[model samples]
Target: MGDDSIGGRLSEFIGNLGGFLRKFIFSVLSVGPIPNHIAFILDGNRRYAKKHNLKEGDGHRAGFVALLSMLKYCYELGVKYVTIYAFSIDNFNRRPDEVQYIMGLMHEKIEGMLKEESFVRSYGVRVHFLGDLKLLHQSVRIAAEKAMRVTANNTKFVLLICVAYTSTNETVHSVHQCFKEKRRPMDKFQEEEQQQQQQGLIKLVDLERNMYMALAPDPDILVRTSGETRLSNFLLWQTAFCYLYSPAKLWPEISLWNLVWSVLNFQRAYPYLLKTKMKRY
Candidate 1:
């Protein structure tokens, strides 16, 4: 055989072997304890762009590609819920043009969800926009609604995109909703009469029920890209027992190995996390 042909065959064989090995390891790791939900703080996109001297939104575009790939990995590992902080309420403070670019990107992505991408259909992933809908642009709001409507029947997996979201705002909104929903057994008059009574006190369940992403459980693991360790107003109420992982890489720079490391960290704390959950219940 010619050396060129021989080299081609060998390279192809190696690639196939590598894919098999990755899947095998992922399977083994998932056998013991898999995270039911994982939250991602896709940070440092702008920093990455500046570091590479790329255009304004190029880093975010690259980050979106990384997100799509990670979604596949999460699906393979049987993660039921995946949440990403796509855009924070604070992000609007940037320059008007920059904010407009981000909103346009979000609108495009939400429109893509309505088309039911192959991965979405394959995994039965239900798309959820977790934020104040009224705060979004009218066009984006319509697109988000359509995406949710298109994926409402899916039960296997859930993909939550937090746009225009803030933890403090979520908490305040939940408090308002608690009264609107009448979560407590006591009536308004009774609650007023005995404000100090346990019946009038807000319970954990009441607050949780009113949160934007109340349908899914709190994230078992929260992966934040970049060197920062703070929550940055992401899932504040749901992070009490979450295994927070901050890799020293930008959002677009994160890879499957980063996810594996995050999973390994979660595995290390599995016993304690499980005990905590049991106690809460």
Candidate 2:
């Protein structure tokens, strides 16, 4: 081993540099109170495209890339769950061509997940469509179902894609089921007979148990892009104690820094948030 050996020292140095970068990334994330679940309202895809003068659907394509990066960052930061408002039921009101384009994009992504070598496979991410899935196109729905089935056994991470989802609709649908199923919405002191007839009535747990997103826990952090202040009918029931972060960046421009800051901010508020949630519960 000569001191002047070019290959040995250079390769060793490159490996060291790579390790340092990886450690630096994880160390930066270690500063925060890592959230258990993070929900994203991925807005401004169309606006981002328009702003850049890109093609009509190009903004959405870019936004999808941003989503993949966001997921990787969250995993590294120890976030176990992620729910994204991928598509709203209101999106159906858009021009038919645009709506169709979004559905086609979803189909392509779902089909990609079926491959054993894809991101969904590599990351051991479980895919869940949390909404009125029947409203989706037949092809898209089939692909979504297949993705869920294939990833059902994965417990490493959960990704809930809110396609055709609206929080208002979720509430209404849950209420309707409560009555239809003849659930007793009463306390323990009120009625013994009703309890005998049914396990319970319209309790908070009842509604939650019946929600489309019942399997996932409440989100600890909710992120909305494009500087949006309101929830826009996303995760109304599940966000009772969530720390909501609204960033000026559009969905297409969301970066690692944005996610890092979001987690840091959640850490800052976790104490107050936990106190408030405990009181509420």
Candidate 3:
């Protein structure tokens, strides 16, 4: 056989072996309770770029590749919902060039996913752009809307991308929307306001229903890369009962083992989480 043919066969063999191993590992993990929803904070992209002496944009590109791998792993593990902190409202405070680069990158990626052979189609994933999408760049916002519309019928899994987002902003926006929806006759509004006090008559359900994150349930496991302990205004309200896992690795350095270990730790704490949730209800 030619040398090129031999090398190709060897590479294929290794790929198949890796696939088998992953499936075996996941089958064992299935014995424990798997998280229904997993959320991620895409941290350390800029740091990774600095550490590697690469352009800031290149680091984000690497982070995008890492994101694809994590998505594949999450889906293979039967996680129905995956949410990513793709871009935060706070991020716009960065250098103007950096913000523009990131937005362009987002536009590119969203367009890529709309292709027939893209990851979303392969996995039957529904795409949701959560939180203040109006804050996105016009081109990026249009791309996001198109992706959501294109994938609206997919039923097997979901991907929630938080761009131009902050939990505080989401909460405030939800409150405003709730008030708009609950608007009544002036006299009725006054009567309700007086009965409910200065806070108004808005119930928790009303706020929750208006929330941008209401498309999916609260995340069961929230993994923030780069050892960051803070939510950074990402999902303050939704994460109240969520398990938080911070890996020391940067976003681009996240690996299969990081995901596996997070799942293992969550499995260990499943009973406590369930019990706590039950009591709260």
User: Pick by lDDT: which candidate is best?
Assistant: 3
> How many Å off is the CA of 59 in candidate 3?
0.6
Q: How far in Å is the alpha carbon of 115 misplaced in model 2?
A: 1.4
TM-score of 1: 0.87
**What is the TM-score of each predicted model, taking all chains together?**
0.87, 0.87, 0.94
Return whichever of 1 and 3 wins on TM-score.
3
Cα-based lDDT at residue 80, candidate 3 = 97
Question: lDDT tens digits, residues 187-215, model 3?
Answer: 86677776676555688988989899999
Q: Which 10 successive residues of model 3 have the least lDDT summed?
A: 192-201
Stretches > 4 Å off in candidate 2: 1-23, 183-193, 196-200
lDDT by residue for model 1 (1-281), tens = 99999999999999889779779979889767889999999998999999999997998898988999899889888899999999889988999999889889988877765554567776788999988778888899898988888899999889998988999989999999887765547666877876656645667888888899797988999999897899999899899888999999999999989989999989999999889978977
lDDT for model 1 = 0.88
lDDT of 2 by residue, 142-221 (tens): 99998999999998889999988999999988888777666435566656767676645577777887888888889999
TM-score between model 2 and native: 0.87
lDDT for residue 17 in candidate 3, whole number 0-100: 96
Clashes of each: 0, 3, 0
The most accurate candidate by TM-score is: 3
Clashing pairs in 2: 184-201, 185-201, 185-202
